[model samples]
Target chain A: MIATETALALQAPQLMTTPPLLTMTGVSRRYGDVVALQDVSAMVYPGEVLGIVGESGSGKSTLLRMMNLEDTPDTGDYRLALPDLPGNLFDLDRFARRMLCATRIGIVYQNPHVGLLMQHTSSGNVAERLLIAGERSFAALRGRAREALDASEFPLERMDARPIELSGGMQQRVQLAKAIALEPVLLLLDEPTTGLDVSVQALVLDTLKRLQRDRAITMVIVSHDLGVIRTMADRVMVMRRGRVVEQGLADQIFQDPQHDYTQQLVHAKL
Target chain B: MTLASLTKPWEAMSYGFLDASAKRELRRKMLKAIAVPGCQMPYASREVPMARGWGTGGLQVTLTLLKPSSVVKVIDQGADDSVNAASIRSFLSKVSGATETWDTTEATILQSRHRIPEERLRADQVLVLQVPNPEPLRPVEPNMSVARQMHADADYGRLWLILYEQIVRSGRVMQGAAYPSLVNGRHVMTPSPIPRWDVPKLHMAQHLTFLSAGREKRLYAVPPFTRVEPLVFSDVPYQVEDHAALTCHRSGVSGYFMNEIPQDDGSSAFEVSDSHLGIKTIRQAEGAAIRIGPTWYENGKMPQ
Candidate 1:
């Protein structure tokens, strides 16, 4: 077997005591008048879900996008080591870089409705990445997309329906279908369950957890909702003013925040 | 009249080929293509005096689907002014009552034969192709029923054998005509007669593809983000036949896909070509080359 293909075969989630799926060291991103993220260093470990919690303008989204290479940092380095892939994201030019994102790293945006292709049917959205990955047989695409939708605990009949026709929760499920279809190594959720009701959010979160368990998908979820962070994250980082104010194991951060800002933010949630 | 005059006609509607009802039927098929993602559907046929070979499939789709507010761009064999291309452009303008432009970046709908626009089409735009044959298996097996059954079963053994044959014959897959493609992972459809060089543009293309075959009366859509791959072996690999031997006539673009123009010397010659944008992009590429960032890689880096 070729070294690359063998490397892919050998790749397994070394989650229990692995280094990290992603690492941002001294990363800084600056716009003309505002600094989005400043010297922000963090590690998204394998197997565990890491939550970056902060308020509206707290740079959580910026940090998440930076990890996805959606927004490249103005200074410092960001490294993403996908299993069996040569080089990091920055090594590829524009075309190959995008192909990498479609193949390895999948991002689900906050607005469930907008993230999916509205015009395409639920099945279309779910099977998009597989097609991009060059799975060209219709039967294969349909069977795989159907299986994915089934695995998500979403209805099979609704697969033919458009996003607009489906409920908010189903839309999130479709988004999940798209993200998980490729079985990406690093899954980035930018508040995926934001618009759903509490019950629906629970279902969505449960589905995500199940998927993460089934595939050793390392996830980094960005959100301001403490409840979501507490439920999903194994490790938590609280940010304020473009910096990590407090970070620790979720239980530890929830019980005892080191920074005053973290305390104030947590207390306000209470 | 030859198809060359179908350029930039304003407020012209095709005399009577696509009546209101026929257009509506075509529109419905287009919507189904978008809805089903990769499924091919039948479309109402429109008669174009220019005949089938010269982009009538592309022109018909453009005419039936074009909105009055749309800006249409047309290209043939990747050149804007190729006789066949000019013909389609004029036909679209005269029939659809839409405006036509040579600027691919500005066009809302692009009618193309044998080439994707050199520029990446926008998400809002639609790309219509004139398909000689839509089925990738048509060449291997003449029977559509057998081919459809093979597609239905996802049976690509025959297609794989053909690719393997190419590898056996040549060191690489040297077959470059209307390259076979896997669309949305459900169908292995042809991107009409576009060269294999233009095949990569169809993969994860931001714009949608509305392909029609006037002869077969079929229409299909490859939605944006739908995966489109040309069948190739991992070792041999599929490759685009870029113009390593020629340069753009207007802007001196070297090694892009080119169209042959016969010279006074009685030998076939090539000029820089992009069907969607015409020769104008050659000039733009020339100007941009001077300011190109060092990080911007060119066609030379394409894997051989």
Candidate 2:
């Protein structure tokens, strides 16, 4: 399985040659004078994980929301450089945006209950997204749903088990399965493991890491934990007060911090 | 007062129970309903002899369209002999002097509650379905005004949320009847309380269908050749109850929708839902010259 995934990913010089999947510049948003984000700029490339780390109210979640097309930037040039689509994604109509959300983008919230339908069985949650994307054949739906649950390492016997009946860790597993079921081109995570126990957090993190590697999927993750950012992120962006303090390679940011806030964050982690 | 009242001409009731002006108003609203397929048009539902919420809307439409020569058929859940069906059929005939029928092919206007006929209706036929509720968005949005706005915007994406909840819990969509379907690709309307089995018969059908609710005071139409597609995820296709392979206990006919009757033993017996179709089959076998028209399904499968 690992061999096939590695062969399919084919991490080579061409990965560096591929264009960025999403690009944003000078994006700002405010709600009645409460500045959530101000002039935040970033670009996410293919086969890479971009981490945004900040404290609460730092606009990290807002940035991730814009990346997933859930919210639009008030002032910026944001383009979803998908090959088939033209122009800025924010300019697209409601129906087009809905289609994009149903087909191309996947998001996992910090609270598993928010992302997953607790009343649904594990496989049913995964298959719901597939059905929205217009899968009709029962054999194909059942086959793909089983494959997704197996990929997330959910117990096969408990496929019909509801999320509410499962443990906290298993609930997170169901969200992961649903997020990856559609094979979304871009996956977004909002503090995916903030509330889990340390031991279970490690397990979910390991599964996410494997999925990211095997699927060659581009992801933007928002979290306050530096350790999580270091474990999953190829490149890191630090945010403080709705601004990017500093961004660079994960090792460079941790080893040789330039900005004062970056230095403070990196030292605080130690 | 008694002398003047006695001198005045005696009258029993208006023709067809609804006045000529009431009929004209219904005709205007129904015309508008058909102009934009599946869009519900409000009408002034007048009081009839029968009570409301009991196929009164269908009764009004059939009453308006009935003439001396028109042949009308009425059924309540596919049973013509049921009290509701028999009463409504007799009432319609008595009011308008139209011929009543139990056969699908012999009727010009077929008024039904709960189930559509199994046999294929001809292009000349009109199917009047009694609607208990017409708004597909009622479950999501209770406010009727808000639902109308939602329909105008064609923002029914949230309807999937209901099915999504069901699918997640049961690993399948569990809605058995009144399935929400999109008509003419613009509006999503509930196909009344018809079974999931009978819904397919309305899709791009040659015959026209009108679903009316007298209490709700709304009526919608599915015109001939209009697309009536059930709202379903592509992966999870809409499923009907499993009655395709079962044979009817009395008529011995296979490959049609059947009602299950549990026996004293551990097993179950099946009977055709369309009571008239079973009667026709039994009579034809007994050497009676009866013609059963082509059905929507053949050999237990709806032909693609």
List TM-score per model, in order.
0.49, 0.77
Could you give candidate 1's per-residue lDDT for residues B45-164 as a string of tens digits? 777778766666666678776767889888776667778777777767766578878777778988877777666677888899888877777655678897776666665645654554
TM-score of 1: 0.49
Per candidate, chain B TM-score? 0.82, 0.95
Best by lDDT: 2
Give candidate 1's whole-model lDDT: 0.73
DockQ, prediction 1: 0.01
Question: How much of the real interface does each model capture, measured as fnat?
Answer: 0.00, 0.24
| Candidate 1: residue B299 Cα off by (Å) | 44
Clashing pairs in 2: A120-B168, A135-B234, A135-B235, A136-B234, A136-B235
